[model samples]
Target: MAQSHRFWNWIARRYARMPIRDQASYREKLDRTQAVLQSDWDVLEFGCGTGTTALEHAPHVAEIRGIDSAPKMIEICRERAAAAGCANASFDLAAIDRLDQPDSSLDAVLGMSILHLVDDRDAVIANVFRMLRPGGAFISSTICLEGQARLFRQVILPIGNFLGVLPRIHAFSRTNLIAAFEAAGYEIEENWQPDEDPMKAVFVIARKPA
Candidate 1:
């Protein structure tokens, strides 16, 4: 947890100066995300760093809540929400295991660059399933860790980041992930590559069956 805290502190700093590509990607993703929204949906965004996508999507919906494990990241999200005048959006700092929301409270849940950060992916999915109302969905974009990103995160990049370790978050194939989500009670709706190599993050939308 200490490592993650320090690691995300650096990430928050880096996000403060995101490149044009990063900013553009988030903007485009928000459009794609909004296209799938149900009118008046209650949305929950996981791993919402600095509320980038949360604030972007909040105005397009009735209610949005963003969660992150990093305290500083959630603080940045709060600050951004205030700056954007997004009263419908809120930010919380909580581990996946400690999420305190009521059962079946949300209409949909989103995980962007966030699932791989979890140590137990299936358990996280199960927790998400428990939080969503019937027929709700979980949208995610993930690092497969089978591609160049693995080499960079495991070998080339510093040894400090385990979020990319092959046997854990990055270990499963896309098929395996689908199966895992299914096991956790979601039916896969959409899955596709949205970027280039090493970082060819794939997006998925999985819904809880009614």
Candidate 2:
């Protein structure tokens, strides 16, 4: 785990230093997700690192809570939110498996690049299902693991695995992802692969039946 932490520290620093082109990709995804939000909604953003997107959409929502498991990430996110004057958004250091909110209280749950890192993705999905009110939507994007082997797995991730790296858990097939969502009690609303991004990620929107 120690080596994993170091490896991730480097990854985080690298992400923090991403060029404008890379940052644009993040912006496009955030914008696409935000465009679907309703005006009177209370949102919960899972795995909200640094609270950047939460801050970006705070002005349009009734309330937004940014949740992350990493203390350092939460701290940075809180600082970023305050700096951005995002009065409607707050950051909490909490894991998705152990959500602090009441069941059926949230209107929407947004998770960007999160489930792939979790060992118990199904549990997280189930918990999110309980938290979102009936008729609520869960918006997310996940990497399509089948295609990643060519670019990231074989070409790159092998180096990390050699260093006794942490297990980078990922299982993203269109069928598998939709099945997981259905298993968690959501009905699929929108599912597609946008060509603007190169990460092989697929955008998905699902709703809890009323």
Candidate 3:
């Protein structure tokens, strides 16, 4: 995790400056996520790179807290929030697995493009489940490394990680991802893949039983 933190920190500036890969797809995700958010809800977005999505959702929720392991990422998030005047949004330098929130304390948790990056995704899912109130949602966008992208995870990424040139990436199929959420007791509310290509990220909205 520490090594991943360093890698992210090193790329934080470039990452913040980069534009969203797919604007239309990103908007669709934001719309779907907003539909699940209540005006008075409290949200937490883990691995919130530069806090773009968190800030976008801030106006719809009472407050949204963004957390990331990289200090530079968190710093950039704070700066973006301040510049945008998004008072309802805040950021912290922390990892989701290490976050100590009281059980059933939050209204929703967002894990956009983050689950596969973690060391123990199941544990993180379990922790998110425990943090949300009954009927709360866990929204996430993850790249499931299967089909065409399988080689990148199985071969290229391994060599890059070994050479200290790339961060670690976990490879799992889309079926495996859905099963993990269901296994953690979350009911699937939405499962979407914007592109037919296996390289596209899968967006999911899961709810805890009320």
Candidate no. 3 TM-score: 0.97
What are the lDDT scores of the predictions, listed in order? 0.76, 0.74, 0.92
Question: Highest TM-score, which number?
Answer: 3
Writing each residue's lDDT as its tens digit, candidate 3 over 37-118 gives: 9999999999998999999999999999999999999999999999998899999999988888999999999999988889
Candidate 2 error regions (>4 Å)? 1-14, 20-28, 154-167, 196-198
The top-ranked prediction according to lDDT is: 3
* Candidate 1 residue spans exceeding 4 A from truth: 20-28, 147-150, 162-169, 195-198
Candidates in order, TM-scores: namely 0.86, 0.83, 0.97
Give per-residue CA lDDT, model 1, range 1-210, as digits (tens).
334666776668677568646665566666777887776999988878878778878877789989888788998999888988889999998776678889999888888877766777888899999999998888888777654456665665445455532222344566677788888778887877655544666678888899
Query: Candidate 2 on 1-210: residue-level lDDT in tens?
Result: 222334444455445455645565567777777777878999999878667677877877899999876566677777777777778898886777777789999999988777776767778888888998999988887776755556676646666556644336465676788899998889998887666344656678889999
lDDT of 2: 0.74
| Cα RMSD for predicted model 3 | 1.0
lDDT of 3 at 96: 89
